[model samples]
Target: MLSPMQLSKKIQGNDSSQRINYLYQISKKVVEKNPVLSAYYGNLAVSVAKKNVLKIHPDIKRQLCKKCRCMLIDKKSAKVKIKNKKKTKYIQVTCNTCKMTKYFPANKGNNHRLWLENPEAIVEIVN
Candidate 1:
């Protein structure tokens, strides 16, 4: 299987510009008259790009999961714990199903804490 970085480059590579444009066009075409459809395509573009993001930037990769043609924020996004130990930051992911745990470096900046880690919040960040 391709590593996350490889997959990310493939998705965000210049070759994919056309596909991304197409998704935007489709999403725009249905936005007003068919909002649901617009959202469907928007979600698709985001989904496809998300995997690419994970590949290119594995630090935050686990937050998004593939769902159909769109990338959906895995419920597990909320399950991640960020910590600063010694001179490095770490991410801890808990498996809700099997109770297994995995760890990674918290490489990305902390912009997402407000969204994923915030309580009393019911929101999703697709794009």
Candidate 2:
């Protein structure tokens, strides 16, 4: 029922998604071995997604440094620290490359209480 042009656009979107996934995988594999190469792949993936107006998967997005766009491997490319303030526990992940910091609130008795620890809640970012 769709026009040829519409079908072609759909195919192109699928191709873009596949390419992005491939790039993410490559970056993940090489991140520990060669950070520069991994970062190159990550940048390529981001550029391709941006060009196609596609969103990178949240799992992949979270593993990258927002400041340097570098692939982050724990204790290797990133340093993670937990801090408590006013009875609130939070985690700070600092990228070793750019020294940029990202903080996530922890165990706040909220709905988001450690998504990894909660098996019942679906791991989807809500808006």
Candidate 3:
């Protein structure tokens, strides 16, 4: 098996999306051992996407701390809590390293979903 660094180098020759994904995976794997290095990889992934004008998936984006560029693993690198304010329920994620907090709406009885998660959003399937 190729090491992460070697795998990353191999992926760098491929498409932007694939590179971003590999970088993020490396970041997640390294977070527990070295958060700074994890942040570096995470930042690199974001930069790659930006340089190519590509969009990162919502699920991946949400798992990253915007301010610190680190992976947010629940109860590990970050704390997750369900909060309610003004009758709106939301999930709150607090990054332990940088203390950055992010909120996501999770109100019950609401049928809203991200565009990508909706079935109508897919127009074609590629094999």
Candidate 4:
């Protein structure tokens, strides 16, 4: 049987998205054991996407700390809170490792949704 790393390498061949996803998975798995290594892998994933001009998945992008390139796990590596200001409510995520904060608008009245979440965003489905 091929080792996990070798399998990942084989699966990632010629596909930047697959490679980024693999790196993100590796980073998430290694976060508890070695944070620095996790950050390194996360950075690698981001760099790969940038180099290939590919967009990272929204869910993966939101979970990564922009400044430190670390995976932000709620209540462990990050803090999550909701805040209201100027009639706008938003969810705030603060990365404990680098003290970085990100905000996402959460106005119920507006019914805001990411473009990817919309049904119309799907043009084709691959089997």
For all candidates in order, the CA lDDT equals: 0.44, 0.66, 0.75, 0.72
lDDT of 1 by residue, 23-120 (tens): 54444444445545555665656666665562222222333222322212224212567777888888665543334455666656655444333322
Runs in model 2 deviating more than 4 A are: 1-14, 86-88, 106-127
Ranking by TM-score: 3, 4, 2, 1
**Candidate 3 residue-wise lDDT at 70:** 93
lDDT of 4 by residue, 32-81 (tens): 67778778888988999999999887777877888998887776677877
For candidate 3, what is the TM-score?
0.78
RMSD of each: 12.3, 8.8, 5.6, 5.4
Q: Tell me the TM-score of model 1.
A: 0.31
What is the alpha-carbon lDDT for the whole of candidate 3? 0.75
Return the top candidate by TM-score.
3
Q: State TM-scores per candidate.
A: 0.31, 0.65, 0.78, 0.72
lDDT of 3 by residue, 21-123 (tens): 7777777778888888889988998999999999887777877899998988876788878788988888788888899998898747754333213323222
In terms of lDDT, which candidate is strongest?
3
TM-score-best of 1 and 4? 4
lDDT of 4: 0.72
Q: Which segments of candidate 4 are over 4 A away from where they belong?
A: 1-8, 11-14, 107-127
